[model samples]
Target: MSSTTLVIGGTGKTGRKVVQQLRALGEPVRIGSRRNSPPFDWENPATWPAALAGIDRLYVSFQPDLAVPGAAKAISDLTYLAVAGGVRKVVLLSGKGEQEAERCERIVADSGIPYTILRASWFSQNFSESFLMEPILSGTVALPKPEAPIPYVDTGDIAEVAVQSLLDDRHDGRIYELTGPRQLTFPEVVEEIAAATRRYIRYVPVPLEEYVEGLRNHDLPPDYVWLIGYLFGEVLGKPGNEDVSGDIERVLGRPARDFSDYVRETADSGIWNRVPSSS
Candidate 1:
């Protein structure tokens, strides 16, 4: 059996880290991305088999998100192909509180392949690397769900756990809920960033509908707007979503990175210090 591991979404947030860590451990890895040799695209099933060929292990991070429509069927089809191709183990990155993502989890679990699921809280990097970055750069983060206390886990921790799951069969069939050690509300997050960067950043809480309308007004894709709305409405502030989990410590023998730690490190990188351009 081939020992190669295929990391789907390998260029993405957690995927890239997983790839890096695996490579650091001297494990064979193939990046499954549209730009790779055997391109793996989520929307195109024809690209999958080639990427899965000769691969014994897999790391699944769905593009956009698994909450989107058709994600379950996509996971189902991918796992089916993997099983037929003799892929031995699979590790999936999933959203902590998303019901829709759970459906995709079931597909991978029942696929007759050994699997581990990492159900993660909202990422701390969302503020520095994702949609929230723009608002931070603009100095005013007008978002909904101001009061929702989120245990924003770092992608670094998530990646470490993922790498452990991929290489060690001990993690097989285990579902790990990954979260940071503390919860912070939107305003508190802003304050931490503000202090770390020594820049004035404001957090304005808006109505959910108003926030969605703002995204539409800015001409963001309809699907992206829909996802933002779904995440804020369905997942944020829901009970238990804010609770911190010790799974990271359990898996990696260390406490999960705190949001403040992320903020300080990212601040040192000067990502939050960039001057916003005036149009």
Candidate 2:
């Protein structure tokens, strides 16, 4: 029953939704992002203590990705500070296929706080707001994941679950693996977008090498390239991950939104209708 909720990565896809939901429920929400008040920068550990000062509960999301290097150690360090600062509850966002992400989850469980783990599938927003957005706006999306079937979870559902977990003590210690109700391959997902937007969207299968080179050609950092490569090449295609999960329904008592629904919704948002940002 913590009223003051701290959401890290609070400006990103799922975090933004979580913040909106918490505020809608009349909870006092604090955003923990590089630009948020009491700014929290993951690379700068000095800012961690200030962000945790008044927080009794936390929705912790690491930046870029949880699968990246040093994530576990960073989580471990942050959890120590949270515990020391009187944090009693935590909801950690985790990647479904990432062992590294799980390492961070374990650290939170060991932090002696009431905790919930939301092991999320690839996000539908990956195409609309994340790395895939640019490629889509350019009319061609290329990646290493051509045949890799994914159950892309909606950010809305992830936020709903996160808000519930932060507010409900009964949900503590639960590990929920949330996915969409159906699975889709990259090309198939692209086709769904094409159908939704009434436009042609092509999906190309590229080797990891070529994808990294593409990232470099855009003057992006290698860290971004490496993270993207790992997700597309390592996490996207797999048997255990391709199936849908009912955790979203079980937690929220409603069916998860489909990829087609997400595409249609985002298509109208004008996010896809305009030129994608180069940032």
Candidate 3:
């Protein structure tokens, strides 16, 4: 309880929730971000030790994602430094279906530091807070994998498990593959949102190549385009990823938030209905 925890990607979806919950509990939390007073940049290793200083526990949520190329090495290097910096425990957030993410998980496990791994499914917040938000607001949720149902876990569930892992040694050396209670396909997700918001929303299923080209037309960077293609084509396209785990209930003693609940709550927040201002 006396430990100061460092949250990498502190401003991110689950990272922000973790920081908020920890601070509300009067737990000492350090925001590890490139824009922080002492910036922590993933591409720059020099900023790492400064952020890890005086941090007893670490919550690592890698930016972009652990599935991207070079992520395993980065996690490896950071875990090595974290152990050397006297960090006692680490809770790493990882992608469930990504082989690259699993490789990064192995790096953290082999670092000689006590670790908890949350290999999580896709996030429910992606519809409200991430790249998918723009498409949803545009009334068309277009992408590949219209048939694949993803058990999108709530970011809050992920954060709660992370906090418990950071504080409890009992979770050490455990890998929790977290997900919601059910799976929802792209069209089903849109239907939920449309019902909740009373708006007309379309789920358009396009070819992977077309989706990539659309992203390019929108001027999304090439790296981002590749990441999207990898996620939709490789990760989501996998059949076994439609799994639901009891890890959220196991770790937090409560059921994970369903996608319908997420849609309803997010609708009340007006995020899906917000009108973009003229630039």
For each candidate, give its TM-score against the true structure. Answer: 0.97, 0.94, 0.96
Instruction: Give per-residue lDDT, candidate 1, residue 200.
Output: 90
Which pairs clash in model 1?
A: none
lDDT of 1: 0.92
- Clash number by candidate, in order: 0, 0, 0
RMSD of each: 1.2, 1.7, 1.4
Best to worst by lDDT, what's the order? 1, 3, 2
Q: Which candidate is the best by lDDT?
A: 1
User: Per-residue CA lDDT of candidate 1, range 22-131, in tens?
Assistant: 99998999999999998999989999999999999999999788999878888989999999999999999999998889999999998989999999999999998887
Give the CA lDDT, 0 to 100, for residue 9 in model 1.
Answer: 85
- Alpha carbon lDDT of each predicted model: 0.92, 0.87, 0.89
**Clashing pairs in model 3, backbone N/Cα/C closer than 3 A:** none
Ranking by TM-score: 1, 3, 2
**What shift in Å separates residue 31 of candidate 2 from its native position after superposition?**
0.9
Q: How accurate locally is residue 218 in candidate 3, as Cα lDDT from 0 to 100?
A: 84
RMSD of 1: 1.2
In model 1, how large is the Cα lDDT of residue 123?
92
